[model samples]
Target: MLTTAEILRKVRALEIKSKKLTTDLFTGEYHSAFKGRGMSFKEVREYSAGDDIRFIDWNVSARFGHPFSKVFEEERELTVMLLVDVSASSLFGTIIASKKDIATEIAAVIAFSAVNNHDKIGVIFYSDKIEKYIPPKKGKQHALFIVRELLSVQSGQKKTQLNTALRFFNNTTRQKSIAFILSDFIDTGYQDALRVAGNKHDIIGIKIYDKMDRTLPKLGLLRVEDAETGEQKWVDSESKLVRYEYEKDFFRITDYSNEVFRKAGCDLLHVRTDEDYVKILQRFFISRNK
Candidate 1:
């Protein structure tokens, strides 16, 4: 557990880092990647020569016996939601940073970016169930509050149920929002929930993983415990068959997550703990523009 001073220092450091990233890298990319809610009806006006014919108010035109155009203004406000996983598995890491650490940084970057763009930002922290829900609000203060919570929030449950988070997000957020799910994704049976949410909102999955997660080192026999289930097991990491099975299981889960996101028509990005997530995020934002 982090002391109050330690948490405050970390939060401050994260705020500075996230502010720089948002200002220097993500500001324009984020704006381009996500658009506003949609166009909102403003008023009816006298038709101009270059006005779009589709926007003509037929009823008003009939009453006035002349063509009048319905004017609309782009609704420029957006709500950005971060669906963060606080499962115990996220605390595991063998290189660079733990999944939870990387997630907090990424979430902070996105939160700051949303604030920079004048968008309302919110969070849904979860493990096997919803741990916390911060309703969408605008301003730098709100964004900073989210950063603090991301660094300090804890979950009583250890397992992960992606469907629970997805269902809650879909049910609570009525307006279409841009939601980013940050997790290791060590769970299953979330395809239907993801599909339903995808149909209603813009969903993106950021899978934070460590290199060790994919492959075990060639060490001798080692005992490992299941973080979520509290079960213990002994494994011969030196055995080729054991290592192969470990890697195969990792890929199986990863591949299934990929297929699920793809089938649901959602964007997913995989980032290793030691890799440059800035480049990955920049490329993703650029690709979204294209």
Candidate 2:
């Protein structure tokens, strides 16, 4: 467990980093990436060149005897939920930071970006079950509180039951939202839930992975532990067949994960532990914009 002071310190540092990313890098991209509910009428204005002809107010124009345009504002107060995986697998990382650590940073960045754009940000921390849920709200304080939870949440669960989190989100949030699922996605029985949630909300999948997960270095005998199951086994790393099987298993798991998002009509991003997440996010936003 993290102490109060430690939690506050981590929250403060994250606030600084999130603010920088929200302000400097993700200022406008986030807006374009996640759309608002709908457009609302602001006011009528005189028609100008390049204005969409579709928005011309014919009734007002007939009354005022001039071409007028209807200005509509995007109902941009969006609700963003972060469904984070706090399972044991997220604790496995051999590079710079663990999967959970990287998830915290990315979740903080997303929270800050939501608040920066005057949107409500919420979180659902889960590991086989719902560990914590922060209701959606707009404000810096709410976002900060979420960041604290993201950094300090401790769970006894060791497996990831993604369907539970998705079902909760689906039943709780009545209105449409931009939901982001951050996890290594090492689980099963979540396809129906994902499809149901994706039908009503704009869902995005962020796959967090470690480089070692894909490749195995031949160093004679090797011991591997499954974090979620708490099972350990020894394998002949030097054997060609063993290494080939490991690589094949990695590919099969990754492929299934990718297909889940694709079939759900959602965008997916793969971010390794050592890669630049900012560039990855920026490119994702740009692609959505196009």
Among these predictions, the greatest lDDT belongs to 1
lDDT of 2: 0.91
Model 2 C-alpha lDDT per residue in residues 46-127, reported as the tens digit of each score: 9999999999999999999999999999887889999999999998888899999999999999999999889999999999
lDDT of each: 0.93, 0.91
Alpha carbon deviation, residue 38, candidate 1 (Å): 2.0
The C-alpha stretches of model 1 lying farther than 4 A from their native spots are 48-54
Model 1: lDDT equals: 0.93
Candidate 1 per-residue lDDT, tens place, 101-207, comes to 99999999999999988999999999999999999999999988998899899889989999999999989999989999999998999999999999988999999
Residue 25 in model 2: shift from native, Å? 0.8
Q: Give the CA lDDT, 0 to 100, for residue 164 in model 2.
A: 100
* Model 2 pairs in collision: none
In order of appearance, the predictions have TM-scores of: 0.96, 0.88
Alpha carbon RMSD to native, model 2 = 3.6
Backbone clashes counted, model 2: 0
